[model samples]
Target: MPERPEDDDQQLGSLRPTRYATLAAWAAVGLVGGWFLHPVSELVNATAPVVSWAQPLALFLVAAILGVTAHATWRSVHVRRERLEPHRAVNRLVLARACALAGALVGAGYLGYALSWLGSRSELADERVVRSAVAALGGLATVVTALLLERACRVRNGPDQA
Candidate 1:
């Protein structure tokens, strides 16, 4: 069963934190969907799109940006270096939650795609698997950074709270 948030969370207008189970569910969906892509394309005689280094690099860049955001948020809110606006914090929190879920799906999807290429005779199989695996790792990093951002948004007990 999903956890029920305490009354105080609602009273403070805070959203319930994103759950790992939900991410897992999305990843499962992506995995199954990705596994079918190759076979379906083959049946239709369509070629698979090339997986490139640029894809993984972009994901890694996003992860880096999120990590910086998380660190900034942690300093502003948790460390009390500066006061953060309520709306901005909420926005960041929502972005973090959404990205975390998205990252999980993308990661699993790439992993499934890579697995499908294993033992295949095509010369492209090795390239696809290697590139897809790197992309999957980038996606995992995105998820980790996003989760860190979410955790950074938490408001610790301070002099104002009861």
Candidate 2:
């Protein structure tokens, strides 16, 4: 049997791009989570010696790796003659989507925590603010890279296919 146009349309629509609203919702959840966790973090800081630099650095590294991988994947898929494996492409899309959501949440949470520390007169307030800000930046980087990766996964249709 011949394939219907509607069937092809449905298949194309299944590859829809990620929505901003979904990201926003995740960020909102992060904001609320951060607000709640701020006090707990402060309490833990008071009780134990915590390294402030590690979190941001780790996030930054993850972001950099994701960005590089995304770029390579895009180049391989669009510019190079080699075709991407179906399983590999699906895996990349899944990873990108997961990272995008996670990055949004983490970034919002760190930003919220940093805002909470702003203008505080406590001895560790400056350090906390700075670290949180850096972490937030790292998170932002992850979000941006993840979004780019997601976009890179799009399979452009040729004139004949379209």
Pick by lDDT: which candidate is best? Answer: 1
Task: Tell me the spans in candidate 2 whose CA falls farther than 4 Å from its real position.
Answer: 1-6, 9-13, 40-51, 158-162
* Top-TM-score candidate index: 1
Per-residue lDDT tens digits of candidate 2, residues 68-143? 9899988887677357787887788888888889989998888877777778787777887788889889988998
The Cα error of candidate 2 at residue 67, in Å, is: 0.9
Candidate 1 lDDT, 49-99, residue by residue in tens: 679999889889989999999998898776765667878988999889988
- List TM-score per model, in order: 0.88, 0.84
Model 1 misses residue 85 by how many Å? 0.5
Give lDDT: candidate 2, residue 79. 72
Q: How far is 150's C-alpha from truth in model 2 (Å)?
A: 1.2
List per-candidate RMSD values in Å.
Answer: 4.8, 3.2
